[model samples]
Target: MLDYHFQLTRPSLDTIAGILAALFVIYSVSWIIYTRFFHPLARYPGPFWASVSRFWMVSQIRGAHADKTQRELHAHLGSIVRIAPNEVAISDPDAIKTIYGINSGFTKTDFYTPWRPAWCRYPDAFTNLDEPLHASRRRITNSLYSMSSIARAEESIDKCTAVLLEKMASFAEAKRTFDMAGWAQMYAFDVVGQLFFSHMFGCLAAGHDHRGYIRSLDLLLPILCAASVMPTYIRSLFLIGGALVQPRVMKALTSLKDIDEAAEQCIAERHAQLEQGKSGDEKDILASLFAVMREKGEKVDFGRTEVKVEVYVALFAGSDTTAAAVSSVLYHLMKSPAVYKKLTNEIDEATRAGSLSSPIQYKEAAALPYLDACIKEGMRLHPSVGLTLPRHVPAGGCQIAGAWFPEGTRVGVNAAVVHRNRDIFGNDADNFNPDRWFGPDAARMDRYMFQFGGGSRTCIGKNISLCEMYKMIPELLRAYHIELVHPEHEWTTHNYWFNKPSNVETRVTARATGT
Candidate 1:
């Protein structure tokens, strides 16, 4: 009674709809069953939803902080938790070596592909896909990020800090609540500008985001974060280009284009200045980049693109991350008055003893044990990067937490997860207690500190951030007695990827004496 002619191809609308719906259900059920019961990672403990689908992971990210979610997941599921069907978050501090260690054969996942531009076919230092090529890129200009080289620009750092202090003093005089979060961002961006171009970005001087760079990045970051979860660069690019955000709006925002254009303009200007026999700070990043270009360009394959990537990475890394970190130190200090007093007391003692200098030399700040402890503790509680540092397994399988992971598996350790591990950081790790850094575990804790990441891919601009934080935190605390405007409320932070703290309203008053 059934007409089994090729009616399936030309089915009625209702029949077609019914068939499609049925097929979708069948596919969905099949995928869930396979992913949960037969996938290589099926044995790992995680949320029931996560075991069956990646949408669960994406939904959690859409809903809350990935860092906190990951930490809670690890706590519930033990050392390893399947964050997604294809990804696992390892909380074991010891696993850092296996995952991110040099020569570990665990290369970067596709998460970093968006950082590279299409024209620049070669991978720069920060791109995660090509380790060997990027490693070579790192070698060419590693000296530019060296402590000594960054120290050469100490005068520039001092100038930026002085300007920043002047702004703080104005806020103290006005008795106006300081937007410490915004100011920290300005100072960081201005510092990077001075370091690269022999001039500041006018952000600190303007007392707001100059040229809309900060706002643009802030607006686009969520879209970028969402795109990051995509499986490939093309897919992520499509999402950024218009899949998630409107094309016109994305075009209006200057995330990569602004940085690239700035790099191009700066390089062109520098080259013209060079042609005219004008010289810049030899220790400045641009000068060092040029030096490497002339000295080892062919050997290391350094060129205009490499220079741009370096400048791009420096500005991108230095500004937002350093800003967030500086804010963290300030936020925690305001929240925990005891820690604040102890740190300021140390600075006061050192100042009275003439051990501290104006601008607070990096060495001087490094010498203050309590100050150091406070910085370490703040970063531990809130690392800048919230996502797990995902790495792809190589040809041979590797062991982690006593389990063998097959090649090409995605694995990473979230800084928050490891930083708060009770076994490693002790039971009080969840609290902002700086005293944890004073004992025997201090060295071990330092080894596990993923605030700036680990292994060969550790943040190269770390000295810049360290120098800024080490110098500025003590300077601000000693010069101005700061308290939270809303002492009862914690600063607002959204951990889409970067746990950038904002809503930091602090009242500042100038102290009578540094001593």
Candidate 2:
């Protein structure tokens, strides 16, 4: 009787497993057929697998070349490609002004929903999907991050730059080949730290991740990238597993929790310092945030929670993205010897003439035309963030890139695709020739930069990155002769969300006169 009961239950379990597998297969097949043939986006060009399921897009993103792959698809499929069952990636630069323009009526899609931290009262500017809220948040302290406002805090950037140069100077003296990309990111974090709390993280001084900031980014970006490709339920499953296992790990790994706690500490410390008259009158970004809240009153929705969330967002977004940009620029400069020489010559000339400050100034850097072209070319070649900003089409359907996109269709423009458009940037768009910005159609081409995005909803913290890049690059070039460790090979990069380059190992030699 016992043997008979065991046999009966085993078969019953096997039967149930078999039934579930068969049902899943049947459902998958039906879903694929419907999505590929009956879906509205079915008529559009895309990978058949992509049309069948979002898993195709997820796999592509996880494999870490979605940007390059999408670019190739657009090149083959023309300006538009159905990147998901409900989403289309439009490559034409003309799609920029139409989709992202002020009052274009295209609202940010759920793709950005995951970017907001769970602890925040309202989403920070980068992830805020609510139009009114985003606009209000931007209005509250947008001026504080403006190029003019950032330039006023030039000493903070200069301090960060000085620390970075000193580190590079050590590498030069020791004649050691170090990972410039890692150092660049470290320096960027320090810059944000200095700008935000009136003190650097001492990452450059210590020569490391410095409180596991970069490690948290390494962990966080992939999750955010996956969230873009997969369903929220699937993402929840991932987070659930991580939530269970991560906390139980032997070693204490840096997570978003660490960053949040640190941000809160920063808020308290800044408040104490302000109250004690310890903080100088220069007004760091945090100080400015407080000033806005006090002066504007409760009519403005900016509060302590909002300030903390902004701190976390700005620290990660400002540092990670800016680091990517700086790394890419430096890598491209290393790759293109002639262009690199030309830019350095311009900076050196300016420096020797006593026109440029020791660490360079944003205004002075802006005056260098070749340097300007190089920066633009670097960004165009490799946008810092290798992801599309998905926006939902409004009611009554609209046209884009000569194709009609129906209402509720998710549409976006990827810089990786749009920047390489042969029609706009010319036929040699894929190449790293800075002369494109100097061409007769330069003004027209300038409109398509799209790195900081376009129109009213553009990145509010963009000036912070530009402030650092414009000042730091010229100063670094003036200070050292940076040579790539592997000049013949392209620097290896991976795009989780930010298209960060990690293979930039370089040897720095101090420039006598400039130093």
Candidate 3:
């Protein structure tokens, strides 16, 4: 009886294994056939492996040169290139309006899902995928980030700028070649911190990333970019693996927790001030937000969580972007001595004419055409966000770049690719030339500029960043004689979310007056 039972079970196990192996082979062949020949996007051009798997996109992003890779792909494979099985990168200028314009019906894709903070129950304005919800959020927050609001926050910015100048002076006196990128980030963070929380983050004072916020963000961005292209199940598995294998994952989480705690503390302090009748007529973002909440009453309520999350969004979104822009502008200016001299001459003229004040004012800076051109040209050449701003083709589908894309396709425009189009930006599109922004085709060039993005989903912090750049760049140039530490070699960059400069080391000395 025992011998008969053992024999029967062994044969059954063997038969089951054989059946499973056959099923695996069949599924693999079917998937390959579908992806290669039968998929909706199979007609598009891309690397062979990219057409079959998301791994290619992942590899490009992981390599930190996805922006350059996408540009090369567009150069070789026309405007539309299949980056992933279901994703197409569009670089045609005409496609901008179709994909991102108001009422375009192209919603943000799941690629943004990983951008939502782990602490938030609801997605913040930047990460909200649903169009209606995003619209609602944007509507509520629009007033707070408007140009007028940024104008009101200019004093806070000026305070931080003073600190930055003081820090630079110390560097000048010490005759040290400092990491300008780190200093730019510190300046950005301090300015945002002061504007939002009524406190400086003290990064500049500390002369280092004391809270590890920068490092945390640096680690987190790559992970998010990598996970964005992954299948949901696979992404989950990857995250689990990351937690087990990578200590940086935990550091990132801890950094977020620290940020949340700091925000809560700020909120608590504000409430205490309000209760004690010491909440003066401050005009910072926190004050403006509270004013809105008071006016709305119970009709449009904002809970503690909502307020905290909004503050988190302001800090996270505002800091790195402005820093990258600052770094890009400075790097380009250093690279092109002619452009730098032209820009500094503009600043000096403004100062001499008494139109610009010490630390410079946003309004006066706005009036400098050459300064504006330099800022625009720098942003155009090296946009902070390196990856494509992805959007989903809405139901019923739509035409994009003169072709009809089916519903549910992921379409996006990479700024790096679009900005370098020779037809739109001219033959010198790849070169850094501020003159392009001041030419006869300036208006036409403006139409394709995606530095702050375009359409309804444009960056809410655009005015804030402009305010910083417009003021700070002029101030720095006017006060210091700066030179790149390695003028012979080009600086390196690593693109995760922001195309961050890796080695923006520079030596600074105070400029002799009336030179």
Candidate 4:
């Protein structure tokens, strides 16, 4: 009886062990097969490890060394690189147009959904992917940014520009070293507040840095990288669940709440005034938006959630990015004295010739040849958005740089790579040469200097930003000359959808231009 029982149990145990072994072998074989042949990206040419791994992509951002990686990849791969199995990085100008141009059948990738705050009323403002929805939102905001509106808004512009000039003059008079980068932030925040919310954050008045309502929002580069590691559904989990629960994420939402609450209050005040027939020609983006909505006979009450989000999006977008571009241009100018001196002269000459006093006109500032050169050169060398905001190919797939790619392939144009392309800008592409802005030379700027991106999705706020910078830079320089107190100063950078400055430190002392 003992021998019979032992035989029955032994066979059953042997059968179970064999089944487990076979399952393990199947999984191993399937993984190898996927990496070797079944993967859609298996046919693309790239680094062997990169084709099969997500580590390289995440590591670049994780190490805060994306610039180094991009430079290396471009150096090794020429104009086109298959950075991942499904994505290609194109550095050529023609390819940029081919991939990002209005006709290019590419749309914003699903990667942006998670970066959006949960409380966003008009979540569709910046996060929407469908082309028609984007168009509709653009229509609502377009009038506020029109040349006529900006011209009409010149009183506010003058007030803010004057405030900045006065502050710089004080620093120049005192001969004290101050934080120029910090001041730029203050100026930008204040200006954006005045224009968008009909209020001022008073960052400039405070002198020192003030953590305003918008300070908590980090651009979510880490999340973008994590999402890139796997399929779209898996990426959604990281953004929807993982990111929203993080402390930093919560802080950002809180900041947004502050801005929204304040904006809603201000909107209420403006609407009340309008209802009372108190028409004294109020100034601000909110005032104009309210006016437009009223004229259209749309009365759904002011301070609606969507209205608040729209206001926040415009304020946040206008302030930070423009400030960054302006600050970078200033930093580069300080580093290159020849460029600085040249730009100063251009600003002086243009302002003098025009005799502009109250509000610096964009039309006049746009004519400053050297100033234009300096701005273009600065944006090219250090783009605000370092990574190409990834775009998805249409359903039928598309051709980029003469290569046929499958549908839904993630494609992007790396500004860092394209801006430094030797083929278009010549060998000194990396240098800050403002001379490139003059004559037919400026007109010859390659299509690839997509600092603001390209096609219909290009920045809608370009005119407003350029107008502000065009005025602000000249006015600030007119009041005081700036020098970098720490000549060897360096700032940290993070690789988000935006190329965020990390702990950016600088001292701004005033100097005369030896006029």
- In lDDT terms, which candidate is top? 3
Q: Model 3: clashing residue pairs?
A: none
Model 4, stretches more than 4 Å misplaced? Answer: 1-38, 43-50, 53-56, 117-125, 208-211, 219-246, 249-253, 256-280, 297-303, 351-359, 439-441, 502-514
Residue 244 displacement in candidate 1 (angstroms) = 8.7
Q: Tell me each candidate's TM-score.
A: 0.93, 0.94, 0.96, 0.84
For model 4, residues 13-48, the per-residue Cα lDDT tens digits are: 999999999999998678657865877656555665
lDDT tens readout by residue for model 3, 396-467: 988888788889999999898899999999999999999988779999999999978788889988998999
Quick one: best TM-score, which candidate? 3
Model 2 local distance difference test score = 0.84
lDDT at 366, model 4 = 70
Name the runs in model 1 displaced over 4 angstroms. 1-20, 233-254, 280-282
Q: lDDT of all the models against the reference?
A: 0.81, 0.84, 0.85, 0.68
Candidate 2 residue 38 Cα shift, in angstroms, is 1.0
- Between candidates 2 and 3, name the one with more favorable TM-score: 3
- Model 2: lDDT of residue 131: 83
Clashing pairs in 2: none
RMSD of 2: 2.5
